[model samples]
Target: MASWLARHGIQPTVVERASALRLGGNGVDVRGDAVTVVERMGLLPRVRELATDVRGMQFVDATGRAVARIHTQDPASPEIMRGDLVALLRAATDVDVLLGDSIRALEQDDDGVHVTFEHSPARRFDPVVGADGMHSNVRRIAFGPEERFITFKDHYFAFADTDAALGEDRWVTMFNTPGKMAGIYRSGNHAQAKAYFMFRSAPLDYDHRDVAEHKRLVSEAFAGEAGWRTRQLLDSALTDPGFYFDALGQVRMNSWSDGRVVLLGDAAWCASPASGAGAELALVGAYRLAGELAAANGDHRVVFPRYDAAHRPLVNDKQQIGPNVRLKVPKTDGGRCVRDVVARLPLMKAMSAVERRAQARNARPLPDFTRAA
Candidate 1:
C-alpha cells in the first residue's frame, strides 16, 4: 500500500506494531490480477524466481504411502513463500515506517483525523487506512467490535517450519483421519518444509496474541494422532518459534470505511487462508484503494466509496471457501475416500481447467490504475 501510494505522489506513513517486519508465513498464491500488481511493481521476475514450485498434493495412507495425488500446477498462478513475497514488497516500497508503535486513539473531524500512538508522538493524517490483518486494531477503534464482522468457519489450523525430508519432493503430502488433517508442504525450491495441521472444532477460548496458548491448542488438537508421520511433524512444529495458529475465519463487512478511516486487505475482508487468496485480495485491494485516492485528489469521501465498490466483488468471490475446506479435511471416512478417488481421476484436473477458463471469461479486466490519476 505504501508503495502504490508513493507511485502516485502520495506519501504514506506506515505504523507497524511489531518491532521489525514480519517475514514468516506459509506459501501464498499470487494469481489473476495480483500477477499484474506484481508486474507493475517490477517484482514479477523476482517473484517467479522465488516461486515454491510445488507440483501438487499427495494424499497418503497410515504407513506414509501415497494413495492419491492431484496436479495443481498452473502457469497463470504462481505460489511463493509468504516471507519471500514480503521481502520483495518491502524492498520495493520506499516510505517512513514507525515500527513497534500502535494507534492508541483516533478522533476524526471534518478536516482530518487526530491520532495517538503507543510509543510515538501523536500525529494527524488526512486519511487513515487499516491494512492490518483479520483482527484489525483500526477497525476496532474506528468502527465497532470484532464480533460484528468476524465469522468463524468451524475449524482451527496451525503451521510451522519442519524437516524437508519428512515428505516427498515437490508435493504437499497429506494424511487425514475424518475431520483431522496432518500434512507436510515440501516446496521444490526451498530447503525448509512446513507442517500443516487442521481439525474441525467449535469455537475455542484462547488469546490470539498468546503464542504459548496457540501452541497448546494445536498440541491438544493433534495429541492422539500417531499415524503417517503425524507425531514427528507435530513435535517439530511445536518447537518452532515462528509457529502460527489461527481459527479458520472470515471478515465480512457491510462497508469498509468510517469517515476519514478506511480498511484494506484482511482488515476489510479476509477470506481466510483456506481460500488461498489472501495475497491476491490484498494486492488488488491496495492498488485500487491507492488509485482511487489519487484519482480523487486525496478526497476521502470520493475515494472510500469508490474503493469499496471496486474491490467488494473479488472479496465476495474469494470468501466462498466451503468447498476448499471440505476438500482438505473431509467430515467423514467415506467423504475422505470419495475425495481421494476424485483426486486421482483426470476429471478433477479437467474440471479445474474448465473453472479457470470460466473465471478468466467472467473476470473484468483489472483497471489500469496508473492512468486513473
Candidate 2:
C-alpha cells in the first residue's frame, strides 16, 4: 500500500500505536491474486528471499504417534512468515511513520477529514483510511459499535516462542485432545521455535487489552495437561514476552466507506485468522485501493464506491462460508480423525484445485500504472 501511494506521488503519514515495528505472528500464505500484487509492487524477489521454509504439518496422538501429514509444498498453496512480508512492505515506502501514536477521534466533511491523535498534534488529510486490524478504532468512529460487526467463532488461541528442544527443523508437530490442540513450529534457522495452543470455547467476558489476564486464562486452561510436550511449551509460552492470545472471530460489515472516510484491509472485512488471508488481503487490498484512488485522480467520491465494489465480492466469497476454525483446530477426537482421513483423499486435492481456479477467475488484473504518466 505504501509502495503504491509513493509511486503515485501521494505522501502518507503512518501512525502506529506500538512503540516500534512488531516482530510477531505465525506464517501467512500468499497465493492467487495476492501474488500478482506483490509482483507488481516489485517486491517479489525480496519476499521470496525472506520466505519461511516451513516443511509440513504432522498430526500426533497423546502418545506422540504420528497420525497424518500435510506437506507445506502442496502444489495449491505457498506460505511465508508474517514478519517477512511486513518488513518488505515497510521497506518499499518512504512514508513518514509515527510510532507510539494513535488516532483519538476522526471528523470528516465533504472537503476533508480532521484527525486528533492520542499524543501527536491534530492533522487533516484529504481522505482518511483505516487500515488498522480487527480491533479498529477507525471503524468504531466511522461505523457503529464493534458488537455489530465482530462474530465470534467459539474458540480461543494462543501462541509464543518456546525454549524446548523440538526434534526437527522446518516442520510443525501437532498433538490433539478432545477439545484442545498443542503444537510446536520449528523455523528454518532453528534459533527460535513457536508453541501454539487452541481450544473450543464460548465467548467469554474479559478485557481484550489485558495481556496479563490473557496469560492467566491460557495457563489455567492447560494446567492439567501432561506429556507429548504440552507442559514444557505451556510453561515457556507463559513467560515469553511475545505471547499472543485472542478469540477466533470474523468482521462483517455491510459497507466499507462513508464519504471521504474509507476502510482497507481487516478493518473492513476480516474473514477470520483461520482463513489465512489477513495479510494477503491487506496487502492486495491496499494496492488496489491506492490504484483506484490514483486512477480517479484522488476524487474519492468516484473512487471509494468502485474500490468497495471491486473488492467486496472476494471478501464475500471467502467469508460467506462458515469460519475455518474447525479445520484449523478440530474440536473433538472424532473430528480430528475425520479431518486427517479427508486430508489424504483425492477429493481434497480436487477441491483445492477448484478453489484456486475460482480465485483466479475472480481476480481482476491490476492496471499498468507505469504508463499513468
Best by TM-score: 1
> What range of 10 consecutive residues in model 2 has the weakest lDDT sum?
70-79
For all candidates in order, the CA lDDT equals 0.91, 0.79
What's model 2's overall lDDT?
0.79
User: Would you list the clashing residue pairs of candidate 2?
Assistant: none
Tens-digit lDDT track of model 2 for 136-200: 88898889788998899778888988873853577888887777888988767436778999888
Alpha-carbon RMSD, candidate 2: 1.9
For model 1, residues 1-373, the per-residue Cα lDDT tens digits are: 8999999999999999999999989999999899999998889999999999999999999998888998888767899999999999999889999999999999999999999999899998999999889999999999989999999999999999998888899999999998999999999999999999999999998889999999999888888899899999999898999999999999999999999999999999999999999999999999888988898899998989888877787788778774788889999999999998988899887876776676666565677888753
Which one wins on lDDT?
1
- Candidate 1 structure lDDT: 0.91
Off by over 4 Å in 1: none
